[model samples]
Structures are given as structure tokens and as C-alpha cells.
Target: MSEVQKYTIADVASRNGRGGAPVWLIYKDSVYDVTSYIPEHPGGDVILEEAGKDCTKAFDDVDHSSDAVTVLKKYKIGEIVEEEKKYDANGKKKKRVVAAAPENSGNRSCMNKITCGLLG
Candidate 1:
């Protein structure tokens, strides 16, 4: 496969369908050029509302079907730059790691009670 194109937020924002430019938006840090798909969109002009912006939350709020998602993939032109990416290499959202509590102070008895409470 060809090397995927990389775009910065400014690059995506510039193609906002104004003055004959392409329409683009970001979802999960991946960029898409949806100008050609605009007319066929089931949501009509509603899709335009997200032009040149990150629309992941709005897209998920509607709970798009698998077919819709598959279609969306066809228009993917590239991805947001690495510094701006919210997902890992596998396309999973990077999980926020909570630091484990320090064990030095907690009594063994307390931990045992908590463990038993969970298992019991």
C-alpha cells in the first residue's frame, strides 16, 4: 500500500469547502475529504455543519451504522499529524493510565479486606 498522507490541523482546516475548496473533517484524528460524498450523505446539510472540524464526538452521538462507517473510510484522504493523534498505532484510542496507588503505606490487612470484599 502507498504511504498514507499526513496532514496537520491547519491543512485540514483550509479545505473547508469554501471558495471551491474540498470539504474535510477529522474523526479520531484521521482526516477525510468528504466534498464529493456531501450530496449523497444521508444526513444532508447536517454533515456540512462539521466541515473542517473534529467531528468524532458528533459522529458517535448519532451511532452510525457499520455500513455508514465503511463508506466513510472510502473518503479518508489521510490522518492528523502524530502530535495531534488521539489513537494508538492500531487505531484504538490511547488509554489514559492511572498511576497505581503507592503500596508502602496501605496495611496488608486493609488490602486483604478489600480483596475479599471484591471476591466474596
Candidate 2:
């Protein structure tokens, strides 16, 4: 397969429709240059609400028609860099690793056990 073009989120953000810059937004992992479609958008300027950022949830929430989906594919310029993709190859959302809560000192645990026993 041909190597797919890759773009970082920053690259997509840089195209935000400010001044005369192009309007680009990410939907899932693919970046779409919607600048040309802006005027034709059936929803009018509402599309600009998500300029330069991921609009996966918003797009899906709208329950767009199959025609809209097809039109969206036409504007796809490239995929987001693999490291930055929110979904895996199979399109499942990646799990984020959250920092664990801090470990409590032994004193706190011991005090809590004793206090629990007394209250019982």
C-alpha cells in the first residue's frame, strides 16, 4: 500500500479559518480541508464551531446522512500521525493511562483501621 500522508494535530490547527487560512478539522483520525465547502455547508456557519480540532463526536452526534459522509470523505487530506490518533487500527478508542492516586503513608492506614474498630 502507498504510504499515507500524515499530519500532526498542530498542522491541522494551523489551517484554522482565521483571516484567509483554510478551514481544516479532524474527524476521527482523518483531517479534512473544509475551506472550500464552507459556503455550501447546509448548516451554514455552524460548521465553524469545531474548526481546527477533532469533531468526531459532534459529527457522529449529528447523525449525518450517507451523502454527507460521502462528501466528507472527498475533503480528507491526510491521516493524523499514528501516535496522535484517538482510535486504533480497528477504530476502537484507545484507553488513556491516568495517573494513579498517591500512596498513603502507613500511618494513615493504621490510624484508619484503629478508628474503624473503635467506631464498630
Candidate 3:
């Protein structure tokens, strides 16, 4: 069997529509290249707003249908690397680890909201 590829948050972040590379986003620890889907996204360019970052919360908030989730599988390129996992105060690993946005991306809180919602 072929081994599944794993990508670190940094690796995924670096590929965000730059140098002609596709944009990758993480959902439930799986990395997906949604570049092709961008133009066709029902929500328009909102998806691109979270490009190269984790979007689990935002995706779940929309309550995608089973068929929609199934469609997402086609874009699955890899899983998040182990080191990117985050832990809570009790040391249990969190289900979603929001990736750091690029330095020039304004408003860190907004990016956090895009990935994990307004817990802060």
C-alpha cells in the first residue's frame, strides 16, 4: 500500500496561491488542495479568505451535507504533520490546530475566527 503524505502547517502555509502553486487548507487534520474549487465555491471567494490555513470550524459552521463532505475527499492530498497538533491544559490533543497566518495578513483575531471561531 502507498503511504499517505503528511504536511506541516508551515509547509501548507507556504503554498498559498504563490508561484503558481495551489492553495491548501486543513479540515479535521486533513490537508486539502481546494484551488480548483475556489472559482466554483458556492460561497464565492470566502474560501480563499482562509487559504493555507485550517478551516475546520468555518466549514463545520456551514453544516455541509454528507454529499458535500464526500466531495471534499477528492481534494485530500495529505494529513497534518504530528508536530502541528495542539494540546489543551489537561494535555489532551485538540481536534483542530489553527495554522498561523502570514505576517502581512491583517488582524490575527480575524484569522483566528476564520479557523476556530470567536472563542477569544
Candidate 4:
């Protein structure tokens, strides 16, 4: 099989709404070109705010439906490079930091979670 394309964060950032290049963004380490879909986005121009940057948190915050995620597949472009990904001193991708919940709240969602690796 042919190799999948891999892009650096900088490579994707440079194409944001400039010239005629498509607006690309990263989500969960996967890169997508959403230029054409911008106008069709249900959330409207708000999506543009995340152009050229990692939109993982913003995307998850909205709790988008599975259908919305399926739609994103059509725009799939590539994956981010390893060196371009944020990593801890031990060389793993930085875990997402979430705030701790109140005591006795029965909530322990603040623990660190491993994100997709570079190839993923």
C-alpha cells in the first residue's frame, strides 16, 4: 500500500486562510483540511477560530455527535509528525491536564490519559 501523508504542525498552520490554500487543523493528532466545509459547518464561523491550530479540546468540549465525527472523515488529510507533537521530558506526547474535582465528589476524571502517538 502507498504511504499515508504526514505533516508538521507548521506545515498545516501556514495554509490557514492564506492565498488559496485550504485551512487545515489538527484534532487528536490527525490533520484535516476543512476549507470547503467551513461554510457548511453547523457552528458557523466559530470553527474558523481554531483554524491552523489543534482543535481537540474545543471539539471535545462541544460533544459533537458521532455523525459530526463521521463527516470529519471526508476531510482526512494526514497525521502530525512526532517531533511536532507536544511531548513530556520522557518523550511521550504530553498528557492532557484536567482540573481536579472537589473532594467526595466521586469524580476522578482528572487523571492523565495517553493521547494518540505520532503515527496514530
Model 4 accuracy (lDDT, Cα): 0.81
Question: What is the per-residue lDDT of model 2 for residues 1-120, given as tens digits with 9 covering 90 to 100?
Answer: 787789999998888888888999898799999999999999998888899889889999999999999999999989999889998777678899799988867456777889989998
Instruction: Note the residue pairs that clash in candidate 2.
Output: none
Ranking according to lDDT, highest score first: 2, 1, 3, 4
Worst 10 residues of 4 by lDDT: 110-119
TM-score of each: 0.73, 0.77, 0.67, 0.68
Look at candidate 1 and tell me the lDDT of residue 92.
79
**Model 2 TM-score, all chains together:** 0.77
lDDT per residue as tens, model 3, 30-79: 89999999888788888877888888888889999998898889999988
lDDT of 2 at 118: 98
List ranges where model 3 is wrong by over 4 Å. 86-120
Task: Give the per-residue lDDT digits (tens) of candidate 4, residues 1-120.
Answer: 877799998888887776776789888778899999999999887877888988888988999999999999899898888666665545345877789856765533334222333234
Candidate of highest lDDT = 2
Top-scoring candidate (TM-score): 2
Error of 1 at 72 (Å): 0.2
